[model samples]
Target: MATPPALVFSDLDGTLLDHHSYGHAPAAPALAALRARGIPLILASSKTAAEIAVLHAELGLGTAPAIVENGAGLWQPGEGSSQDASDYRRIRAALQALPAALRRPFTGFGDLGEKGIAIATGLPPEAARAAARRQHSEPGLWTGDDAGLLAFAAALAPQGITARRGGRFLTLSLGGTKAQMMAQVARRYGAPLTVALGDAPNDAEMIEAADLGVIVRNDHGTPLPPLDGEASGRVLRTALPGPAGWNAAILDFLKQLDRRGGARTDG
Candidate 1:
């Protein structure tokens, strides 16, 4: 398939940057190449707007808004249209259904006065301790491990929130899938051929929805779960990890799109 001059929608953290609690370097040359070709890189991540803002500055991106809190809201550069009002309403409704004890310790973007929002799962002290000890490694990143996080999620069963782990944090949402966020943004941009890159389950929806889905290899050099093997002849897998992986994925897909007349470069 040919790649077009397209909006390359990517996730932050593990997919594009190491963010080893210290923010690693990106493939600056490759990224510069993309920019030189007039491709706009859009960040879609679980990071809060505040966090994403810092990253945007670091990445040298102007003000491209990101999907914060796992697609709960969309942020655009110089635009604050409040696209996810319904998603937030649903999130609040879901939170209201939970037992008071289960909801007390949580906070969100609204609570922080538009800085960013999040809903906490007030885990039991001991369980929280275990979660902190085993599941969570990066402070201010995760609540705990898969098992521990899942347990915490279970406590919110009544409220219907799911805990998904991303590069720096665990997020709760009222079933806000990344695909939904991607589609919404794509629509605004006339739904151009999308190239989505991510490295975890939370990104599954967006990856599948993209014209091309590229899953970055994990820390162990393992690829994220492949698309349904039988029907996904279009899916691509990358051997590269971190920034290198992102560069590879974008360059390769753009090549494919160019070859097939699916995309074009400005220069």
Candidate 2:
């Protein structure tokens, strides 16, 4: 069978985009390189659909489907979502139903209005509003004294929800993970040699699920914890930090792929 183009699932913040500035300029060369080769770069991020929608346009990714709200929803090209998406209201309701003590510590976006979100996220007021447009998960700074967060997690567990800790906050989603969504995306492309890039614990599953795993160095000046299969040759970690590291690693991976003549192999 003719080999399909390699599918790339990339996390935005701290990976493809700068952790602080939220710019992907350093990765421009790599992005262009992939574009030239017709590689599909699917942005899978914790950002909301509104946020990713603007970014998709900025990146010139006309109508390509993007995984939004940390895989709790999918955004296809065109007017709006082509598929059924998750309901943030349900997540909020569940949180509201939790015990006051268990819920008080989790300062989620639901509690932070646009202004507070803007201040906390370092985003502009409008951008913060878009971020608050949650469809699946709720993200916020986990400010809890003692074991409150642990109790919160336990409370959420039985509700079919989980908290994914990122650089700044813990995101709560209902049985949704980037890895699961990426695998669903793979089915669309005949499962071409999957490569995933990420920089934090939230990305562990997606990183592990990839045929080629890329651990992009974060701004913290450290790499993430060991993924389940990093000992093998399929995983790579960048030497630099931020998008500079992201660019270099992607270029290297592409060159390696080119060495195989653009053919997807089972190896």
Candidate 3:
């Protein structure tokens, strides 16, 4: 594949999409600019491939792979919805193998069923079904105390299952991060300049790894603490929240790149 000037990796729920409505209409302008400039926008999220594929097609990303299942897997364009679920199965098995005391506190998607997922995520029934079709990771609520959570993680460590706390859930996977996937995608595109935008702690690695990082304001979730990049002016925060903030931060950054004669206009 030919190299583009830059690759943009973004988190979906609380970054490029609204926290409550899950809409991206507010980001249309920046999305248009990216398309015009030939910059590929890679959706990086904790959402499943089944879930991400819908939005990926809606956005017309055309063949760009997405980081799905919280980076436990990649969703290549045209790939079937029935992806390999071995990893997800392994994660589930590991959870089951834990002592009952530890296992009982974590109610994963597999345990929740479609209806429970719908209630938990506030997604429609159909969407919840899609979200439940996990291919690589297990996200669940951790009801145990902090010490118990720590013990749970330690017990799972022997099985190569790591836990990550996202905005609302504790996710368990064999362990690939958004930043790791970002680097892989960048290499596939010939290592172009990278930009990452997100709104939560799980997004921190990806944001910090990028050449330019954006922390889209997300008043609905735990605020990400100030990162080191902010002091260097390499990372920026938005005044608006969700897609609106995403739009403004992206446009402003691209403009700054243009001013510096660094924005790529050629394909």
- Write candidate 1's Cα lDDT for 1-267 as tens digits: 223257777887678876443243556765776666666678887654545655676777764557765776666666633323465566556656667655545543334332231213233343233222211011133423456555556875566556665644556666456788788777766636777888877777788888878887777322356586316555666687777888777777667767876544455
Model 3, which residues run further than 4 Å from truth? 264-267
Q: What is the lDDT of residue 178 in candidate 1?
A: 74
Candidates 1 and 3 compared: the better one by TM-score is 3
Taking the candidates one at a time, how many backbone clashes does each contain? 23, 0, 0
lDDT of each residue in 118-151, candidate 2, tens digit only: 9888899889988987767889888785478778
Worst 10 residues of 3 by lDDT: 258-267
- Runs in model 2 deviating more than 4 A are 1-3, 79-86, 145-147, 221-223, 263-267
Each model's lDDT comes to: 0.60, 0.81, 0.88
* Ordered list by TM-score, greatest first: 3, 2, 1
